[model samples]
Target: MSETHNDPLARVMRRYLRRSGIIHLPVVYSTEEPVVFTQPVSDNVLGSFCSVTGTGGLFLAARVIRDLVDPDKDGREKK
Candidate 1:
């Protein structure tokens, strides 16, 4: 098994998504590059909730701040 296969955050996220009935995407990781995973919502209810609540924007801002402060931690770049 690869080292990233045992990543705690990845494992927790996978479990949570599974329990919530979210479709899981392939896990990609790299030490020299950033990894991004995108998932499509198969249910209209969840999609509507996400759009109405503006959860995506909130998540984007949080991620931007996280990356700006510590780019290496989350493998994201600061804008």
Candidate 2:
């Protein structure tokens, strides 16, 4: 690629990765409830965010756990 041609190091790494059969694609994150997290997962696409930060990851985890705890669509907490 033209971009890689400019940098020999990048070009080498790209070639190596290709030969290694590794997917090097930009990771895209998605969610319905305010997706505030994002991360780079090698070259393959991830359905959910592979957070690299503690805060965002923790928040997302907490949200999922909390939602699972209730499992109610009417915003009612489980007793």
Candidate 3:
């Protein structure tokens, strides 16, 4: 048996991965280059929101903001 097979943490992680149905290991790499954005964010961008219920709340807020900013896209006029 390999050294990894004998490791307790490795065995546990492998079991967890198998139970989670993850067939392939993730590839991770490090880069020294500075990050660059393709497009700058607009000044009209909405401020971040903290939600108790996670992504669902954030998605709802985004939908409402989109409608408010461009109601014509949704075929409605802003009040």
Question: What is candidate 3's lDDT per residue for 1-79, written digit by digit as tens?
Answer: 1123434556677688788887545221122333445899779765433453466566567767877998767533498
Residue-level lDDT of model 1, residues 2-78, one tens digit each, is: 23454567768777777888773433443434334377535543423445357656666776777789876854349
Model 2, span 1-79: residue lDDT tens: 2223344555677788788887542211223343344775565655545554556667567656766897564233498
Report the lDDT of model 2 for residue 61: 74
Clashes within 3 Å, all models in order: 0, 2, 0
- Scored by CA lDDT, what does every candidate get? 0.55, 0.51, 0.54
Q: Cα RMSD to native, each candidate?
A: 14.9, 16.5, 18.4
Question: What does the lDDT come to for candidate 3?
Answer: 0.54
**Quality of model 1 by C-alpha lDDT:** 0.55
Highest TM-score against the true fold, candidate: 1
Residue 39, candidate 3: how far off, in angstroms?
51
Off by over 4 Å in 3: 1-52, 75-79
Residue clash pairs of candidate 1: none
lDDT of 2 at 69: 90
Ranking of candidates on lDDT, top first: 1, 3, 2
